[model samples]
Target: MAELMEQSLLAMREGAQATRDTGAACDRIGSAFDDMRSAAERLVDTAAEISTFVAAIDALAQQTNLLALNATIEAARAGEAGRGFSVVATEVKALSTQTRKVTDDIRQHISGLQAHVTALVETANGVGARLDDSRNATERANRHIQDVEGAVERNTASMDMIAGLIAGQKDATVKLEEGIASTLTHVSASEIFANEVVGAVSATDSVVKAQFASLEAFEIKNYVLHRAKSDHTLWKKRLAGMMAGLEGLRVDELVDHHSCRLGKWYDHVADPVLRNHPDFRALVKPHEEVHVRGREAAKRYADGDLVAARAAFEAMNVASTEVLMRLDRLIAAFQ
Candidate 1:
């Protein structure tokens, strides 16, 4: 009886040691998961920085492309002296295209890396859940041993289950290590591509600058037109500023800025030129008339004729419906 008891005690001690080993393995796996999560966060931050830099580069490239196009057109117009500038412009335009391609590549790769990291995070969560189950199983086995002094059949079966759990965990930990390592390798490649894009952007400056510096005032106007393409957001903002002044019947700030902008639109942009259709001309006439009236209203506000200014604003609102109707036709055609 004494010898049997010693053997039983020995088995329990061995079981305890195995449980400790399993717990230690879980701890190490948890640490590795934390490290991987940290690395993925760093990659996210780096990708964001790259995105910001790429936006700046995109704006620079667009300006360069536009300026180059104007240079090419004027070279055609120049008929002779422009031949050299035309060649230079073509080269700069090609560089801008190349820069766009590189930025696109970087964006695509970084997006893929983000998806990859998300998967890694999901896997980490799964590992954590599995670890929780493992800890519970270990604890249950310890409690069973304490509750009973010795019972060969039941305790042995429980020991077998714990042993299997530990073995399974070893395999899971190996897989987690491999997965994290693979994701890291992909992130490294994306980082390298991002760096390459940065280098290409740096190379574009000299050519872009040289091409832009060569343009005269007239050619610069072409760039201005390219940039001023119909943007209702800017139009709305300017109109709102003007209305803010007009609404309060305060024309002091309006004369210099918002009023001047409207006047310029009337003076240059909305100049009644030959239209493709007589109907088109008729359609736009109301807006032109209303704009003229709005400016007159602004002047009345400046002269302290508040009633006349408010009535003119009311008329302008009615005419804006005509303008929007014309816009709706254009929008339908474009779509």
Candidate 2:
């Protein structure tokens, strides 16, 4: 049992370390996305400036057209006196028409290019948003792993204490066995000897009770934490689906969907058992803060305040992973 427990502990430690590494990688990825988003925004701005230049060219084409018309009129009044000038005016008018057509074509192409750049900017924003959320989730997982490690450390200390008590019990049992053998051989067991055996048995009971109580606590911890892990996974899957459904849902619908998800998790999975655990109880205020902020983010989104939503989501996401990982590790220990 000891060897098995040690192996399990080692595996868990390795897993936690791996998860921490993954979180750091996720943060790096998020940073890269942020850089990309900034680049995309700059591209959009440059494209907008190009669009302005196109507008200026369009205006210049109009002015040239007006000038060509005036020249044609002046040449017409000159008649035979300005025959060459009339020919030149005609050429100018044709050139003006061609210039206008070319400018119109340029305008169309620039408009298309602007649309594509705008779309690229929006795409970058969405990807950055998702990456930010992923980073937040990973960070939360890392924190929960830390909490688990702390709890495991405590448990380890408790196990060491229990080991000491067991060692004492083993010594007492050996002495008792020798005493029994001596008593049988002598055909006389003293009251003092009987009292010593009784004392040892009582000590055994006391140690068992202490260790048993701790082990029993694991039962409840195991159940709740296991349920929490499952629920966490479900919550993530549901959130992913809701995000994918963004195209079909309006702001209100999106908020409602997310709110309902949180509510169900709170009511059935989190609130029911989590609110009661001392560790989870301590986690409550922080978890509640995350939910409150997330709700605010949803409200901000509904109000057409994307910047506020993104900021709020970032805050909430960090808190969420911390809470989640704590719960995850608690359950993991029991398993």
- The ten-residue window of minimal lDDT in model 2 covers 240-249
Give Cα-based local distance difference scores for all models: 0.64, 0.66
* Candidate 1: tens digits of C-alpha lDDT, residues 82-142: 8999999999999999988888888788788878877887787788788777877877776
Each model's total of backbone clashes:
0, 4
Model 1's alpha-carbon lDDT is 0.64
Q: Report the C-alpha lDDT of model 2 over 1-335, residue by residue, as the tens digit.
A: 34445666777799788987887887787788778778877877887787788778777877877887888788889888877887887787788778778878887887787788788778877887887787788778878887887777677767777887988899899999999898876665555575576557546645744654565556464544444454444443333333333322233433322254333444555454556656555555556766566566666766777778678767877876877776665465445
Error of 1 at 293 (Å): 99
- lDDT for predicted candidate 2 compared with the true structure: 0.66
- Model 1: colliding residue pairs: none
Model 2 — TM-score against the truth?
0.47
Off by over 4 Å in 2: 160-335
